[model samples]
Target: MVKEQKKRFVLDTNVLLHEPLAIYSFKEHDVVIPMTVLEELDQIKDRKKDVSRDARVAIRTLENCVGDAPPDLLLQGVPLNHPNAPDESLGKLAIFPDHQVTFANPVNLPGDNNDNRIINAALYLQQQSSEQIVLVTKDINMRLKAKGAGLEKVEDYRTDQLVDDIQFLAKGFCELEGDIWSQVSKVSSEKVGRDTYHTLMRNELEEESFYQNQFVIDQGDDFCAQVKSVNDRQLVLKDLSRDRLMSYHAWGIHPKNIYQGMAMQALMDPEIDMVILTGPAGSGKTLLSLAAALEQVVEQRLYDKVIVTRNTPEIAESIGFLPGTEEEKMAPWLAAVTDTLEVLHKQDESPAGSLQYIMDKANIQFKSINFMRGRSIQNAFVLLDECQNLTPSQLKTIITRMGEGTKLVCSGNLAQIDSTYLTAVTSGLTYIVERFKEFDGSANVYLNGVVRSRLAKFAEQEL
Candidate 1:
């Protein structure tokens, strides 16, 4: 019997920065770290950003993997899944040969940069060994470069992939039988703790499984409601129509569409620790989130205050430096915040100084994402806007800052991500929504309406 040789994977620096634990992802395969990768990691080990933090951590992990061994043992590799190892090990980690080796064919690259150097090492390894040597990276251009250089194997690191495509993610709506309207609207119209109660048939359940806070719409009878509770075949609906809102008005910005109504339902639920909203431009994602925060913080006094955080892509990429205090610097990037505030003020018809007064009295804080690291927030409503621009690691950092009695509402339009490394499927918003879909304390809704302006909707649809 012949046993198949395990593949040897060469990881780019970006993979480690994206996930410090990427070493273990190969799972029983042989992993190789090019010397150039170590040099790059060393160069960026002192960086103050998350990339540097990841580099230092990965270097430490690699050092631990190869602790005090013979020079030959490094190339031979160390067990990743060894029972005697301190961490979980599913594969083995090794360092590529330091000596020269020939590639399959002659090649020339545009530049001798770090990425190209890694590709060169991978090519050399492919020629030296009969087994497969694959170059794994998140950078799209690197893959093309490797392919152009005649590398036989290249792939994106997807061990942590939540869903294959963005379409596979939850859309926040569920359909029921046509006759469900009669049974739900008439029979279970009675109120039960923040929502209406209805017992559905096991046949109605069928193959459809409702998420903890997913919305339900039986448009046959104009039925729009939220799933209050899910118990086997028993389904409870919470009406979020005009009459069922917690108060007559939520910070004077009312939910205009059924999706917005669902947003309000999740936002107002004290039990829901996290809420995700995804939609297109002018879909009221930010407005609904801000309004709900105001309602909870100011009207109901649910939390101590409201803290807003945004990954300002425009600011992060261009200009790089903003002069002045943090709030003043954030103001230019938060036009949406200003606009939402204008709408709220116009609807409330308050005095000229009232908005600022409420903002001050309620302790609303506009914070930059850079300083968000290592801060613990408790009893606050945190809104992370424009989250599509964030990476999976960036989103994880933000979410981990959450403390007790705090609600984190993240909203972003997946169709409008600005990051070069992020897409609709890989954006932080999609990552969180898919990962948290099964949790009982997390809820999400996708809004498709663009009620801000007809022209805006036209642009979203046509342009």
Candidate 2:
């Protein structure tokens, strides 16, 4: 039997910008980089945008891969030296001179567009090579154009995509049908101090999935508990009173629903280092997070201060041009935080004064996500909002900045992702929720309902 020929993948600039080390993802397949893509990367590397850093990293990654090879050898092929790739799985990397490719074919798209040039390069490869020639791009329009321009194959870079669909993403809570006890054959109860814990055999609850810090509630709302620990044989759940959870207040803000109650619990927990809240618009994500931050920072004095930051699409470029301090500049984007504060203090006689008083008392500082790098945030509550637009790499950069005695709360609405390069399934919020589900010190809650208003809820469901 004859062996199958290895495939050749032509990567787009957006793919590299989306993931700098994407070259290593196509194991045993030849990776091709067009000259147009290199030029695009060069142009983007110096921009005052967040993607500029990614562009530079992608360029550096390419340099490290085929930098030492001769120009002739680079056009031919250079063996990729990925440390993790197996000997049989190693592939070659080549820089294709798309500019040199003949554009005589009228079917060939005009060279005026970089995307068209990249597509044409892949088209040329398909005509010249027996191996499968595929175009890998993150841009939807580019993919459509490549396919329409007669490319044999095209695909999105899915090396970092954790879930195939948004529905499959972890919700951090499990709602069992009927009574949860009906599904369990046996359970052993224990009391430690004032807390009640129940240990049940893992096999008994095989139908129901459990993870560390995952909340479990019954459909009847009679029983609610949090998974304290899980092992191969047994699962331990900490009993939580549903009434008490509903009554739990944070900076005078109470949960509107059970989902928010769980989120509030996670936010208020001193043991949990990270809490991720994901939901639809007006679902109390920002409100609950801010309320909890204020409660922890001002009332409880658990942390020294409260730092609120979020990813603003034009922040990298527009921030410098905007007037006032960093906090004032960030005010426009962080209006939701201020709006939530107003809601929290609307009943007060001096709402503006109370907001200011609380802001000073809690030492609430609004920082831009662009400036979060290299700063050691200690003894503070960091509330990262609108994180759905961040890539996995960008999110990692911010998460690493968290120092000791700091609690990080990440809240985002996946349905409302604003980044052109990201989707709900590929979002950094989804990535971390799945990645940290089993971590003992982290908790995640997907606030289910829209509590902002009836009109907002109707819009969320219908529009």
The best candidate in terms of lDDT: 2
- Over 1-463, each residue of candidate 1 has an lDDT whose tens digit, in order, gives 9866789999998788767778877766888998888888999888544456678888988887788867788887877754354565366788875334454457735335878778888888877788899999999999998999989999998876788988888877775666455543334458768656655553454435776677777645456666756767567666655345423347777778667777787888899999999999899888888888888888899899999878865654332477777777888777788778777777555655777887886688888888788999999999999998887878998999999999999999888877766678777788898888778788998987898899999999998
Model 1 ranges with Cα > 4 A deviation? 1-5, 45-50, 81-89, 97-99, 104-111, 177-195, 202-208, 228-248, 313-321, 347-352
What is the TM-score (0 to 1) of candidate 1?
Answer: 0.87
How high a TM-score does candidate 2 get? 0.95
- lDDT (tens digit, per residue) of candidate 2 on 1-463: 9876789989999999888888888888899999999999999999999999999999998898887689999998898877565464668899999989984466798888899999999999888888899899999989998888888799988889989999988999988778878888889999999889999888866445679999988877658899998888998999997887899999889888999989999999999999999999999999999999999888899999999999978999999999999999999999999999999999999999999999999999999988999998999999999999999999999999999999999999998888889988888999999999989999999999999999999999999
Please, what's the RMSD in Å of model 1?
Answer: 3.6
**Deviation from native of the Cα of residue 92 in model 1, angstroms:** 1.0
TM per prediction: 0.87, 0.95
lDDT of 1 at 218: 63
The 10-residue segment with the lowest total lDDT in model 1: 240-249
Candidate 2 off by > 4 Å: 1-5, 83-89, 103-107, 206-208
Q: Which ten residues in a row have the lowest lDDT in candidate 2?
A: 81-90
